[model samples]
Target: LYGAHLEGADLSGTHLEWANLSGTHLEGADLGGTHLEGADLGGAYLDGEISFAPAILRGAGARDINLEHIQCETFTEAFGDASVTLPDGYAAGEGKLSHWSPEKLDWENFYEAWRKWQAEQHPDLLPPYYTAED
Candidate 1:
């Protein structure tokens, strides 16, 4: 699911184990009980009214996730497992954070920034948008 546009998608109970979902946009996505074990969500966009209505993230690698953007009763109910790779705020089992509105997150800017981040991270690699031979 690399670089896929899944904005506001209902991805409940989807089996995405060990999949490479890098640079995917998941803003406002319904992730209720979505199995994300071992999934790589690096640079994926989750900054909006996301439904962790009760999601799963065991052993998943999630980077750059602004936990403040994910809407849930608490951080634990929305995410799980200490092994799951998350940002500094929600990386501990004893940690707990409350939900907040989407007034602070800038989705458009975040998405664009991720693209540039990828370029910087991998200088030799070319994005499909730029390397197409057509």
Candidate 2:
């Protein structure tokens, strides 16, 4: 498998060409530069509550996944023709999608900020003494 906790794993880089991975979680795994010719990954969660970000899905099949919520800033040429799937009540391409860039906040900083915001906005879902430092 190319990631953690995959239930049904048949991710042959050649067989799954141009598959869709929107809102899927494939954290802490390795895809070894697979050819994702035309996949879709809109609103996908490559990372978890930790600092680790998922490996790039460059050149994989990505064309119609929602990407408005992703933090990545640099997409591979594979995603050039893909369409970002939007959430309900939102326009198809109106989501916030970005690629990884050095200028963006570091993972630690981003996680901390995300935790803080989540705590403030949803106190019921907040854990006690939630700290992203590990």
Candidate 3:
């Protein structure tokens, strides 16, 4: 269905493998758990308006898929293989957006900030279940 208007469609968990959905208008479509392996998404409108609660493309030929319009957050939620072209400044294998990966976080700084906040908010108060440590 090339160039078809499928706006706001609830296509969750649907198997659309090897389908020619090029240039399809999928705005606000619920593609959660949808299997789109080998589907032709070239020119497909899967921008920020759509909900891709993890569409599967494990073995899809996604080299031609244009991800310029797709949001990084939404794309990260999906499962893709090496064929899928990720947006610039992103990489696979982290199970999360590359920029937001745990390795990139400053845990020490965050812990210090949290400690300061806790000391200021509750100087002498600790929850009964929370055991304080030296």
Top TM-score model = 1
Model 1 gets an lDDT of 0.53
Model 1 bad stretches (over 4 Å)? 71-134
lDDT of 1 by residue, 1-134 (tens): 99999999999999876566778888888888887654656667776577865666544444445555554333432223232334445433343522211122244443343334334543233233443221
**Steric collisions counted per model:** 0, 31, 1
TM-score of each predicted structure versus truth:
0.54, 0.33, 0.51
Of 1 and 2, the candidate ahead on TM-score is 1
Clashes of 2: 31
Return the top candidate by lDDT: 3
lDDT (tens digit, per residue) of candidate 3 on 34-98: 98654545557665567776887432322234555566565442323333456776654454632
Could you tell me how far off, in angstroms, the CA of residue 48 lies in candidate 2 after the best superposition?
A: 8.1
Ranking, TM-score, top scorer first: 1, 3, 2
lDDT by residue (1-134, candidate 2, tens digit) is 22235323334344334444545655433333444433444334443221212334443323333444443433432222224443343332223322211123333453444345434543443334445453
- In model 1, residue pairs whose N, Cα or C atoms come closer than 3 Å (at least 3 residues apart or on different chains), thus clashing, are none
